[model samples]
Target: MQLPIAPEGKVRFVPSIPLALQHAFAMFGSTVLVPLLLGLDPRVALMMGGIGTLIYLISTKFKVPSYLGSSFAFIAPILALKSSLGLGAALAGAVGSGIVYVILALIIQRTGSDWIHKIIPPSFVGAVIVVIGLTLAPSAISLASGGTHFSYNAFWTAMVTLGVAVVVMVWAKGRLGMVPVLVGMIGGYAFAALRGQVNWSIVAKSPWFGLPHFVHPVWNWQAMAILAPVAFVTVAEHLGHLFVAGSITERDFFKDPGLGRSLMGDGIPTILAGLVGAAPTTTYGENLGVLALTRVYSTQVIAEAAVFAILMSFIGKLGGLLQAMPSPVIGGISILLFGVIAASGFRTLVDAKVDFADRRNLVLSSVVLAVGVGNLALPIGRFPVSSLAMATGMGLILNGAFLVYDKIKPEAKDAVEAPQEAAL
Candidate 1:
C-alpha cells in the first residue's frame, strides 16, 4: 500500500496539553464503563488505564501513539468468571491473558510478523474483530433490556442513547464531533433521571478523595482456562489497531517500534493490571478515534492523556459518580458502543480489500460470522471455548490451509504444464 505523506513537525507543549486532555475525555466513558459493568472499581480502571498507557509508551520508547484502557473484549469472560470464581480469580484469568500476549511477543521476536501473517491475514483479522463485537451482542441486549427482565422504559432509553449518539456523530463537527459516545451516555442518563431510574444517593454518599481499591489476584486454573484464550482475540485486535495507526501516520510501525515491541508494550500493562486485580487493559480505539479527528500522532499527546487519567483515578467522587450512573443509561450507551465495534470490524475488511467473491474467503467469512453471532460454543475435552475464540481458531486454521493450498496448487499445475509443453 502507498503510504500517505504525514504532516511533519513536533507538537508544541502548549497545544499538546489540551490535545492530551481531549484524548483522555475521549476514552473516559468506555474505560470507566467496563469496570462499572463488571462490579470492579472505576477508579482502579482509570488508574490502571493511565499506568498501562505509560507502560505502553515506555515499553515502546514513547514512540507509539496509544493509550491503554479496559478491554471490552474481555468483558464477557471476566463477568462470567466473576460470577462463578470470584473477582480475584477472574483477575487471575486476566493475568493469564496477559501472559499469552507476552508469549506471542516472544514468538514474534523469534519469527517476526511474517509467520503470523502467513497463518492469519486481513480477512481473518477482520472476522475476529466482528466476532469480538458479535459475541458480546447478547450481553448488550441483556443490559439494555433492564436488570434481569425486559423493560420498555430501559429499551427506549437505550434507543434514545443510541439515536442521540448517531445524531451527534453525524452532525457535530471538529473536536465536538469526537465525543458522541459521551454525549449519548449523558443524554441517556438524563432520560433515565426524568423517569426516576437514577439513584443519586450513591454519588452523594461517596467521598471526594480516596484511594482506588487495589486487590491481589487469586490463582485459579478454571478461570485461567476461560480467560486466557481471549489473548488471541486481543492479539488480532492489537495488529488491526496498529495497522490503522500506521495507515493514519504513514509510517510502518511494524518496522519502527516493531510488532514484537508493540505486543510487549500492550502485554506488560495488562499483566500489571491483572496482578493488582484491576481490569485488563488494551489499546483504546476511542483514543484512536481522537487521533483521526485531530490528526495529531504525537506519542507525547497520548502520554499527557495517560497522566491525566492517573491523576483522575485518585478522585473517589468521580469514580463513585461513574458507578452511580443508571443501569438503563449504561445499557443505552452500550448498544451503540458494542454495535460500533462490530461495524468497525466490517469496515476493516472493506478497507483491507478482502475479496469475498473468492470461495475460500466466502466460506471463512460465513462460518466465522455464523459461529460468532450465534455465540456457538464447542467443548474441547472438559474445557469449553467461547464463540470468539472458536471463530479465531477456525479463521487461523482455514486461512493457513487455503494459503498453503494456493501456494502448492500453482507449483503442481506448472509441473503438469511443463510436461505438456515438452510434448507440444
Candidate 2:
C-alpha cells in the first residue's frame, strides 16, 4: 500500500509521523558516523541531536524548519584537540564555538548581514569549503585502504556502495531520491555481511534500553583558542544553509526569523551538545534534501523526527548496530559525502556570482586554501592558530583589507579625476 504524501503545509498526525521517520532515516547514517569517528558515544550524539533540534525550534520560534546533527567542520579540530588535551577539552572547545555563535548573533542583530559579507565574501567561503574537504582526503583514503595493504573485497564493496548512491541520488524519482545515503548504507552493509566483514556479536551483546554514556566538559584555554576560531566556518555554513532552505521553501528565513534568531538557535544547541560530551550540532543538509524531495516543509514533522531520534538514543542495540558497520563502508560514503561538500562550496561561489578575475578575490581565496590545506600554523601567544581557524582568520583579514582598499581607491581616483574635469 502506498503511503499518503504529505504536502508542504500541516497534515494529519498519522500522515506526518511517517514523513518524520523518513527524515530521521535520511540523516541517521551521517549522524552516527561522526560519533564513531570521534570515538564518542553514538547514543549520546544521537540524543543530543534530537534535543538540539528541539532547542533550535524554540530558538527560532518554530518558524524555520531545520535538524541539528553532528557537524563535519569540527571533526578535524576535535580529533586534533582530543589527541592532545583529551575529549573533555575538545568538548570545551566545542562549547566555546557555541559562545562564538551567540556573539555573532548579537553583532548581526545590531548590524545587518552586510557586515558578514564584507568580512567573508563568497570566494573566501568557497575556499574554506574546498579546504575542508581536501584536508580530510588523507583520512578518507586511509580508511578505505583498510589495513597495511589494500583489501580487494573492501575496495570493490566500497565502489559498489558509491555507485549505488550516485544512481539513487541522480536518477531516482520522488521521495526515494532523498534517501540516497540510507540506501547506500544498506547496500554497503549487505555486501559487507555477505563477505563476513560485519561482526554480529556486538549487536547481540548490546541491551535494548539504557542511558547513553555522558561526559562533562573541562575547561582548557589552549583547546578553546584552537577550536573557537572554527566558528567562522560554521557561521558561514549556517548562512549558506539558510539561503538554501529559503530558496526551497520560497520563504526568506533570514528576513523572517531574522539572522539573529537563527544563529542563536544553532549556537545554543551546540553549547548544550558540547556540555553533554557530544559533538557540536549544526544544520544538516540531508534533512533539507528530504524537505526538497518531499515538498514537506512542516516544522512539526521535523519535530516529530527529533522525538524519534531521542527515542532511538535509548535503544542501546541500535547504537551498537551503527558502530558495528565496517570502516571501509563508512569510508566509501565519506568519499562521496566529502566530495559533495567541496562541490557545494563551488556551487556557493557560482550561485553568488563571485568574480574570480578580481585580484582581491583571487589573493584572498589563494591564501585561505594554501594556509588551510597546507596546515600552516601561526603562533598566537600560548595557542597556535591552524587548520580551519587559521584559514578563516586569514581570509577575513585579507577580505576586509581588500574592502577597505576598494573603498579608498575610488575616492583617490576621483580626487585625481576632479582636476581633469576642472580643466575640461
TM-score of each: 0.88, 0.91
Cα displacement (angstroms), candidate 2, residue 365, comes to 0.9
Candidate 2 segments exceeding 4 Å error: 1-9, 378-385, 404-424
Residue 234, candidate 2: alpha-carbon lDDT: 84
Candidate 1 per-residue lDDT, tens place, 103-150, comes to 989898888788777566667777877877777767778878886878
| lDDT (tens digit, per residue) of candidate 2 on 242-334 | 988887778888887799999999999899989998888899999988888777788889999999999999998987888788888877877
lDDT of 2: 0.83
lDDT of 1 at 403: 66
Residue 23, model 1: lDDT of 92
Best by lDDT: 2
